[model samples]
Target: MPKPSGRGAADSSYAAGTGIAGRGVLLDVGRYKGSDGPDDSWLPLDANPLEEAEPDAAITLDDLKATADAQGVRLREHDILLIRTGAIERTQDPNAEWDPFGEPGLTYSDDLIEWVHEMDIPYIGADNLAVEQIFQTVTEDDLGEGRKSLHGNYALPLHGAFLRDLGVSLNEVLDLSELAAQCAEDGIYEFLFTAAPLNFEMGTGGPVNPVVLKATDGAGEEGGSEGRRGRGR
Candidate 1:
């Protein structure tokens, strides 16, 4: 079916299960100070997750790769890589919980995109308002002493151009806590999943409520591969 654009939804073809699953890990990339103190983890709506985060503190690339390697699973070529930075976890209002992560993990940059290309990662999804964090602040430990910049806020560049313009797809605001736990227990980081995109032809982004269904064994359908692909660069 031809995908709609402007103001529509993606074709609702894979609204159900795909049957291939063993274990899946949820890497919560959300940013919080991880302190017992009062949760001073609030950031403005436009905060960036990369500014000065400790690599060991949040779900870094190494961690995700390690989890996937240990699972004896190959990430589905077109699977939605859900990234939860935990920003929305702090929001009290469900409707206003678009803030994805607090201040640690941001989305991929151009270099990160090159890494993605090298890794053959199909897609990226997040639970934050934007793919990156809102604030662009760095802590003392993030650098040494007087380093000016560590990581630039290149999320939109990666998303809008690399992913969007370069034909890769990105899904935002995915709830992956349970999925993360499931992967930890079963040692499976890949699953036969499906997501229906909002087919808004003229729209820049669409509202998507993706459901990550748990499958048993390769009930994976050869269907639904179309949405997995995008129409950019």
Candidate 2:
């Protein structure tokens, strides 16, 4: 296949047959208001849905930093940030609608992208099907006259900016409940993370089972009894 038109084309570091290893931080936005339940509008007619849990809320860069601070974890370079919005958990319910097109996820904005770049993190993953909310209405007026719609002009603008511009790889539809549970139980947010992509030559994307390892000792400590691996979906 022809090379994709973005940073991914130039950056061969995360290509298939390669492995990415680094410290990881799980930012649990799953239980955050408006993220715990499915949207009624997207549910099937016969499907009985759960009650609306809470009001809608968007996670900002500040929220990420605050959550890390509260967990006594520091964001550092090469950290693989995993954001859990609890969208995956809802899909596990037989009655819940798994609408890939419309779902709650990180609010995409220029500031958010800048924040990620400033952190110097190499990769990011999310529990939602897409890392950002989809199906956004962009009208001709929104584009403005004569200005061509760029790759970053879509609803999931970060996909283009991160993969194509910044050479960042995005992992989506990850199940993070177990990882979040482990983080909460152990009071540890940082872990040794490793993920290897399928060895497909010239492939754009493939499946991956990312793992997060935490030391048995305790949170923030280096040495521990043993390292336990938390498997991702």
Candidate 3:
């Protein structure tokens, strides 16, 4: 796990405004990867080829923007971005190989970092264990002379970039299949999202069950409590 450079939600002061409720957009990368196959397909998360592939197979920021545009969804400041990468679906397969050290996720690059900063979203969640691809190949040249000593050190760089630098909280290992199905059925991508984490003092992180509320009439209401309800993994 990555350490926070500053105070986190675990602090007493941070707990006051920890509960976030606002508009959320679900970017179903699984659909972009053809996981549905014209029919609702549910497979183990690791079984998904996109999630099991290497960093080269990771989704890019432009892919997300294009998908959002195609789905008629707009990215706004402070929106909670829920990315469905089909990671939870992998749990259905009992014989799947589990690799804690590696998993498929969003591509980690300066462009992605810049995009996130520009979007100004407070929280970003993904169905995968990590928000960015793990064990990415980094050469000594890639690290440059000053940072060459750190080459080959496995780390969650995105976590440090987002949580530490940008003050963005990352939610991972979410089961987004149900939410994705609901969004597809209604052709609605935005919804009222809220997450309440355990108030562990001085804790770096804790568990959270994110609640997603979508309006029955297809008009998303911010902070609205009534509608179809879905929980996080």
Candidate 4:
């Protein structure tokens, strides 16, 4: 059951056409030892306006860029960009400062969004409560809602609106660090990826488990049966 690469889960082309078989590379964004959390080396909760009880320790954007560059893989356009924030690891603990429902750390900035947009990446995902830190904020002058119900609430407002309201989708909390590392080691970051969303017609969103398969290389011999899961889509 090999799939196609260079497209997102909702890319109509993949859904309507034939599939490919290559070396599967899982770009997981879950927590790992080398991950770097949000910048918290400065003020504490008492001093900082944003109420953060503690600092997050997860992977940074630099780590991801370096890893991808070293592997010589040009992050595929329309491919799933899995980011490991280590937030999910913390979420497992009841006493964790960051709440899954509330605001979260490890969000994407405008620069990151610009980069993704330039790359033509249709789908970007993270292994945290949000793809962009919920505490972070972004502006959308194009829309009527500006600087209201957005700041420090849902990380990047423009990003969410662009992804969701604009028809693009963001997959969140898909334990992907180990898988990303494996792909890093193999120097194969692109592969045929397939994710079956819950298919909730009435519901706005649902969970999805995506599987990556290698088609060009002989690595993913087992086919499209192997992969991972996402909490929300």
Best by TM-score: 3
What is every candidate's alpha-carbon RMSD to the true fold? 9.2, 7.1, 6.1, 9.0
Clashing pairs in 3: 43-89, 44-89, 44-90, 45-89, 45-90
lDDT of model 1 at residue 169?
A: 53
Q: Write the per-residue lDDT of candidate 1 for residues 128-178, one digit (tens) a residue.
A: 555544444333333443543554343344554444444455555555555
> Positional deviation of 217 in candidate 3, in angstroms?
4.8
Candidate 4 lDDT over residue span 87-202, tens digit each: 55555546646554443334344445555666555565666666655554333431233434433434346455545444455677766644554554555566665665664433
Q: Once superposed on the true structure, which residue ranges of model 2 sit more than 4 Å away at CA?
A: 1-14, 32-57, 136-153, 217-233
Per-candidate TM equals: 0.54, 0.71, 0.73, 0.58
Question: What TM-score would candidate 2 get against the native?
Answer: 0.71
Top-down TM-score ranking: 3, 2, 4, 1
Candidate achieving the largest lDDT: 3
lDDT of each: 0.44, 0.60, 0.64, 0.48
lDDT of 2 at 119: 72
Backbone clashes in model 4: 22
Question: What TM value does model 4 have?
Answer: 0.58
lDDT of 2: 0.60
Q: Is candidate 3 or candidate 4 better by TM-score?
A: 3
- Per-residue CA lDDT of candidate 3, range 1-233, in tens? 99656344434225324586889898887676544323433212233333344432366777689769877888887888888766566554565445545455665556677778988877888877776666454446444447666655345677777877887777788878777877776778898887776665565666777777776445562433322222221
Report the number of clashing residue pairs per model: 36, 3, 5, 22
